[model samples]
Target chain A: MLQAQYVDGRSTRVRTVSLSVSGTDLVITADDLQRAEPLAGVVFDEQLGNAPRRVRLADGAFCEVRDLDGLRALMASARLRDGWVDRAQRHLPWVLMSVVGCVALVAAGYRWGLPWGARMLAQRLPPAISAMLSRQTLKALDGGMLLPSQLDGARQASLRSQFQALRLPDGEPIRWTLLFRRSPALGANAFTLPDGTIVLLDDLVAQLDNDQQVMAVLAHELGHAQGRHGMQLLLRSSAVGAFLAFYLGDFSQLLAAAPAALAQARYSQSLEWQADEYGSAVMRANGMSPALLADALRLLSKSHHDAAGVSYLTSHPPTAERMRRLEELAQLRPVQPSH
Target chain B: MDQTTANAPQPTAAPARQPQPILFTGRGSEYFGIWIVNLLLTIVTLGIYSSWAKVRRLQYFYRHTELAGSTFDFHGRPLRMFYGRLIALGMLLIYSYSVRLHSLVTLLVLALLALVMPWLLRNSLRFRLYNTSWRGTRFHFRGTVAGAYRVFLLNGFLTMITLYIMAPFMHQRLKSYQHDNSWFGRTRCSFHAGAGRFYLVYLLVLAAIIGFFVVLSMAGVFNAFASINAAQHGGGRVDPSAIFRTMLITYGVAILFGVSIGPAFHALINNLVWNNTRIGEHRLECRMSPVKLAWITLTNLLLLVPTIGLFTPWAAVRLAKYQLESVRLLPASDLQEFVDAEPESPGAVGEEAATAFDFDISL
Candidate 1:
């Protein structure tokens, strides 16, 4: 028999009692009260860790029992099986499997599933929505970071017309528009918005050699636009943010959000590589050599005094690697073949 | 002689009562195993099993918390919670999209949400409390819808209008409202803390944060940013990682301040709230130390990064153990005389919706 705290159904009164099993009947004995309950009619809470267990009597009364070993013995004798969840928890192997399984599952979801899902969703997003998002982003940037273009209006129009000549692989007209802005604080930068508007900063243009290099930079930005990389990156980071917050609900969301940002740096780096490849193809399709883009990158790299940071942390691929691939492409076609 | 050994016995029907300390029996390793299993199931089911997982998690914590020779229990049904989850998810998606779609849509959704927030929160409290039990009797919430609006919306506006100077007053009002309408079995809980005490706590916490900033500035950590800016102004390449590191340092400092301020606020407020709270004639007391709580929280965060969150279960258990064990009830009598309250069922929509929105009710 195990000592227990007994609470009758109708009242919150607790009575000291003793519990025992005899002939398929659960019996509760108190100083002045003796009660018998059928073993089948009783409800036993699953054993979780070593927490106190509650046995609910058929009449809604319950007994709190702390003697796990004795309770297990009674349950076994009465042919009452333990819950599968508790059974699995007790087995060391199942727990070990889950540890490895959970790690692998989460890693797989992070690496493969999240990116794929984001890419699919990004592509399916409406053009109008992307444009509106782009407008909002540009408006925000214009308010703080970006100033009006320092490049002359004539220069801007000439470059715009030059870039207008570039076409898709199918030779159709492109949808992207190249815009210029000056921001000394931002230093050298060129980026494509979600709506395919490419913003070229004056600092970056000042670092370049010729119109061809500028066109090459624009072509690279076009690649990002065509692939909807901005949208994909946004979706990816948001998805990672949402998932990590849920997965580590016990931990601070602030702590969890850090990893997602680091993960996003990796995602954006891959996107850079894809855009580089596309830029090479687009430049080669036009009369311009792929080396123009390579030259622009070299100049841009020279403009920045720090050529190196942790490559993993950087969103762009290494300049040397990108330039090497561009040089290889340039060598593959020494002269542009006439159609 | 059996029940007559009561010390400090008053000349009344009540027995000589002792302060019964609440106990926590859960260990980290056991909870870790359970958490892993639950996470696996949640992932396998694509988060559909989260409601069930939540139940198991809460049950483990509640059942392990013992007081007066009895442990608490949670009886939330997974199916009702799941239905609530669906509704919450739907509204969340609609609301988030509305923000991006148009300003008018955003305003409409916000208005709708504000109108229903009090009702939703009340239902959530009712559902959560009514499902929680000790000694086979349920706890309950009976705060009215109008009362919730008064405390939540009106007081919230007052706090905002006064530039948060009246925040402590609002907090006192909220705590009193919650406690006054709470019931455990047939015993009603009441609270009557002065807002001045809350204001004192908030003022002290703000001073503590400012003190930390002064000390940090004295330590010359602020000069690190100056050097970074000097390096950037030299027309040299800006190291992105350096900037990232600077941001990280700023975040670390902010978190350190939060660790100090947040725990102190909780400790002071919790102490004040529980000290003034009563269930029937019994009194509740909380003795949490802000320094101890802050140290534990800071260490937990530091350890979590290296372990990649494997330390989470232990950290959670550690905090729970400290916080729960610090609380005790000063019983007016033997503590077993109250009858069960009439059952009032509340839907899971409020609780699940709140979870979906990821806001804490601060219970």
Candidate 2:
């Protein structure tokens, strides 16, 4: 017999009782063994640490037994259903393995899986949807940050014609449009919308030495558009946000916003490299020197420092590293004669 | 209502006036093992096991906390909690997506949430208290939705309108409502502190913070003026070491202010809350030292940052142990007389919504 406390569940009164196994039936009796109840269809609370095990019966009465061994024997004999989670929790080796495995899985997802998923999703999205998103974004930007192009009409026309003449190596011609804007706050910057709309700021146009350099910068923005970098970035960040919310239970708005801000501010180094490579390829195919892009970047960095203000490089790839890679590409491939 | 009535129970139980300190037997090392396992399982199950993990964590703390000879227990169901979390996550998704798509819809949702927050807070408290028990007798919350709005919302509005000068009064009102409605079995808890006391504590802390900033700015101006004078007299060159010293002094003052003010508020508030709280015929005593609590908090933060939060379980356990040790209960009657009186269970939706929105209603 196992000594225990019994609660009838109808009152707050606590009663002492003795519990015993009788063949297939578990019997609960008062201290005098004069009164008893047959424990059938009772649920046993899973053992947690050294806490007393509670056997809850159908009639709402519960028996709390402190004898761990006696409770285990009775539970085994009755063949009571126990949660698998309870069993797994006790297995130390399995728990350790699960922890290690989970960390590895999250690391793998962060390094590769999420970016690949974003790429696939970005590619599959309908062009019309992308165009609509771009239109909305451009409208918002125009309302707040951007102004109409400040360059002369003739210069704008010439640049437009020059850009139109350049062709990508691909058989299917890329669908694109160029717009000029003057944004003092976003000085010397160029960005591509989800659709093929490219916006080049007046500061960036003025920084370049010639039309070829301007073409080189446009080619880079075109690379972003063709690869759907903007959309991929958006998808990747939202996915990461969801993952973070799952890992860390909802705590603060600041924590939720932090990751999104980080994802937006800095693009992955690999994505920058890919876009650079595409820009170089497009320049070479169009019979322009890839070195023009490198020269433009060098001038922008110098002028940017002279201005003593935050510049386009705030969100772009590290200038020194990107310049070195561009210089290497310029050296590796001889520039084709300009058409 | 009078001193005589309040002192009646005390004189009758004068022989049993010896306070029993609350004990925390949980060890950091033991809790760390459980925490790591909970984290692992939560990740393995893709967060579905988090409800179970939460139960286990709460149970560990509850079982380890002892007063007299008996320990507390948590009886919250994992499945119910899981369902609540799912509902909360769904709501969050809808709210966030709506904010991006439609500003007007988002505004409406925010307004709705604000209106219902008091109801949610009340139910959340009821659910939490109902699930917690000590010595086989459940705790209960008797706060109503109307009471919640009056205390949390109406007082909150007054505080905002007063530019937060009435914040301490609002805090007092909320605490009074919570404590007065809380029960351990058949015995109701009461809070007995004046708004003036709360105001004094808040004002002292606020004044110290403001004084520190004012002093810092004055020093900054003095240093600038001195440096300008020195530069003009010394051939347009100021000593670099002087500038470095000024920067060092500024940083040291800032760190010192932060370290002092944060712990001061926590210690004062905690001591005030527990010391003034009376449950049935019992009263609580809190003896938490501001400096000691501050040191523990500061060290815990320093350790946590360097270890990249791996020491979180240890930090939590350490803090809990210290706080629990600082409290003692003065019983006016037999503890066994406390009976289970609450019969109705609160709806889990409000509790779940509060959890989902990360509302610290316990505060």
Candidate 3:
């Protein structure tokens, strides 16, 4: 135990003082040591006031007074140590626990909830109805319709050739149908309907500068189909629909109002990013540069230059940012194109 | 203090060292154990008093920890488990009553209300759960139950129009909203990922799995037919059950396909989320490879089939560890702090002189 004594009123003005310490630094304020004793081995100077009122105790331990000088020295020492460990320590535990805990909760939910949900859903349906719906839906959407005879013929031929080129994992050839529609209002729109029916509007065809870009866009849309994005989304919607219908009897009005409802919904940025990555990968696998997709976006943004506020495309992100991201991903080449 | 003052003139003190590794690893297993214990307590208490347990766990992990020379503490008290259960019970009663009435109007009202309750509870609980901060600063979570209702309506709407071509985007946005609205004191959090890469992988994997089963079914058919043909030709007793046997074979093939691929898909989705994590100033870097994820998934899938899916509980524990182990904190280096005091000046002259008269070391 080492000790040093100082009075509170030795200043010419005569006032009180207080002292505090943080970490290894002792801090003394201008109010401190005003009345302190000037004992033997204790040296004092007016010039030394500019420096910290440092004192050496009996055990040879030293401390800076709590005043501004003391705070400065303490802060300086902190800078030298690079106090991230101390700072990060507060967040470390909560973050780690939260991550682990969240995963655990979701896992638990999945374990008990998934099978229960699955069985419950399965039990509600007659196998006959399920099978019929599946087959009928597939046939209805699978490449059966197109507008304009000449355009239809060319697209059919292109699709036939493309489908034949694709091989399933079990070495079977893929069978598909392409549907085309002429829509003046929907400029350059294309999508795969829920049943694997790839629909390309005449407007979409008109905007393609090259076969590769067209193929890339088509491939990206096809990737969504092949990935069962349509299926999951439909299944989820169906669930929501069924729940709504069961609860509220006759949700036709709600179904009709869905587009307006969706217009107000905001998705997490990550989900948007995920879809972008998926689309780009699909484009890459089909032997098309994602840059072309980027170029396609640039064209769309330019075409819709006059659209008020943020359009759906703009809401996704700026075209330049999307393109840059796609290009960065494209650098990791030789990845499987289809998967 | 003297040594610091002597060497302080050189702004490039000690060659300007980098930040040191904090805690090596923040092992959360202890808190996880605490969570489990509290969860069990909640269950045992019939969901009545678990609020205390939740607060206990939160305080132990969050409030007691040190950050930036300040002790972080939760200012808001957590809700009791009993209250949570009561809410659940209330919702259940309303749902059952609506179903029993079987009327269009009642059902609609119940359905709309049922959808809104979860959103409401989430906001209220979050409001209570997350309050104040690392230093003297306060934390504010700018979210409301209405936002949750809006999300529900919006998700419903977009899903209808795009016919779900935009679903992945919707799901992503919901996740981002949850993350962003969550606060650490007052700092807003954000996250991102490579665009749509996993969606492609999902399709490929699904195609492969489906294709595998189809081939297996075809093989079964061929084998069964060949057996029947041989038995008939030999004038031997052909099992009258051969037709049924072939059907069984197809069913078996389908189940086998599910058992093999289910876990892999699960692992893939889990790994994707884990690998793509972003929070505050830290990015979660993952070390788990695709192969590792696939293996974990396969194991879980196999276990899932044998235990009639009961093994899922234990499997979740394993999955969580794998995911957690893969995550590493990558701190952002953009933050810089500035000090305002003059280099040559003594910082403590005026205040020390005023306090010189009071000398109470014992007190």
Candidate 4:
């Protein structure tokens, strides 16, 4: 017999009862009152860990059985679902494996899984949606911080026409529009909107010494637009945010936001690198040294004291490292071996 | 009235003052294993199993919380939560993109959310209380959607329009709405407190924080003055090591007190709400010390930093044990005398789960 506290379903009143299995019937005895009900009619709560199991009687009453051994004796192991989870939880080796497995899986998800998913999603999205998004985003930015270009109109025209001549990898003319903008806040920066609109700030155009340097910057923006890096970044971070919300939502309200922010910085840095490589390819295709971008970056960095972000947490990786990489790529081709 | 008083004989027995302390019978090591395993499954399944994880986590906490020899239990199923979570993810996507589409769209989303949040919260509360049971009887929430709107929306608007001066009033109203209509079996729990009490707690915490910053700034200014003067005379070059040291000290001080503020606020409100609440005729007493709670919270923070989030379960259990064990129910009458209220109120488990579009957002 399993000793338990029985409560009639209609009330909170409790009574000490002895429950026993007789044939296919479960017999319940409370004081002098006795009853037998089919054992199949009883409703058992799902067993979790070592929690006291409660069985609701057929007549709306319920029994809480705290006697672990007795309850286990009556019920078959197959009926006790989720027992494996409970057992694995208690096992030290299993727990250690879980810890290692969790870390590795999370790291892998961040490294490959999420990025791959975001790429697929970004590629499938319609161009019209990105155009609308870009329009609204540009409008919002203009309302806040961005200003009309202060650079001379003639210079803007020359740069635009030169950029117009640049061909895509498939030998097609670049389909994106180039706009000139000035921003005191975003000095010496060029960015691509999701809809392939490249915004070249006056600070960057003015800072570059030659046309090659300026074309290199524009090529970098073109890379971002062609690869749909902006859209991919948006999709990726949203996914990461949703995942983080699920994983750490209830547990670490205090610690959750920090990791998500760090991940964003990390993602953007990698995208920046991809855009740079595309810029290097364009530079080599045009018979301009990949080292022109390195020079442009150096000149821009010297003129513009870049203090916008910390070393590791910036959207772009360290400028020196990027410059060194471009220099290395330039060395591979040596400007022109015939020259 | 005088005739009625004279007709009934007064009972000679005084109300018993026996304090039945709440107990938590959960061990950290056992829970750590559970937490790690749940985390692993959640990651592997792309968060599909997160609902199950939440159920397990809640079951552990609920099952261990014992009051007067009766432990609480959660019957919330994971499938319902999984569906709800999927819907919630859709809404999250809309919310995330709305800001980029236009500011007006963002405003529209916020207004729309405010309009329906009360309704959603109402169902969420019902879903929560309806699933929690003790002694074969489930807890019920009698809070109306209208009541939720009044407390959450109307009061929220008023607080905002008043530039948040009425924040204390809103807090008090939220607490009242949460506690007053909550029913355990047939017995209704109630909480009564003025906004002034809330204001007092807020003001005290604010004052302490302000005082801390003021003192720190004063010390910082005095210390920096020497370095600044030296730099001005010493080729306009400040010692890099000196600056680094000063920054380190400032950050250390900030982190030390910053972690305590959240815990302090929660501890104060918990005590305030629990102490004033009455479950049936029994008065609930919670004697939680902000200092002690803050101490545990700080250590938890310190431990989590070192363990890199592995110590989550142990920290949670430690905090739960302290908070739960500090509460006691002062019995006013025989425990069995409190009968279930409204016999017509039944079948919440089957009825609600069938229509379970709501998720326990708190978890």
Query: How many clashes in each candidate?
Result: 2, 0, 69, 1
Candidate 3 lDDT over residue span B90-129, tens digit each: 7665775455443685769676875766465455545443
Q: What is the TM-score of chain B in candidate 4?
A: 0.87
Best candidate, DockQ: 4
Model 3, C-alpha of B244: deviation from truth (Å): 8.3
- Give DockQ per model, in order: 0.36, 0.31, 0.01, 0.51
What is the overall TM-score of model 1 with all chains considered together? 0.85
Would you list the rank order by TM-score, best first?
4, 1, 2, 3
How high is each candidate's TM-score? 0.85, 0.81, 0.37, 0.88
Q: DockQ of candidate 2?
A: 0.31
Off by over 4 Å in 1: A1-6, A15-43, A56-60, A77-79, A306-315, A333-339, B1-16, B87-102, B218-257, B338-363
Query: Which segments of candidate 4 are over 4 A away from where they belong?
Result: A33-43, A57-60, A77-83, A250-254, A301-339, B1-17, B225-240, B339-359
Candidate 1 per-residue lDDT, tens place, A1-339, comes to 788889775556678899988898999999988999988889998777788888988766789888888888878888888887777765789888888888999899888998898789989988987888888889888998889998899988888898898875556677888889987667678888987899988777777888899888888888899889999888888787777878667457677777887888778878887887788777877777888988988887776665332211134778899889888988896645333
lDDT of 2 by residue, A184-221 (tens): 77888888998879998899999889989999988887
- Model 1, residue A29: what's the lDDT? 98
Candidate order by DockQ, decreasing, is 4, 1, 2, 3
Instruction: For candidate 2, write residues B9-124 as lDDT tens digits.
Output: 55554433446678988777566656767777776687788888888878878877877756677888777667767756766766665555445777888667668778867876
In candidate 4, what are the lDDT values of residues B288-348, reduced to their tens digit?
Answer: 8888898998898779767877888888999999999988886676554454343545553
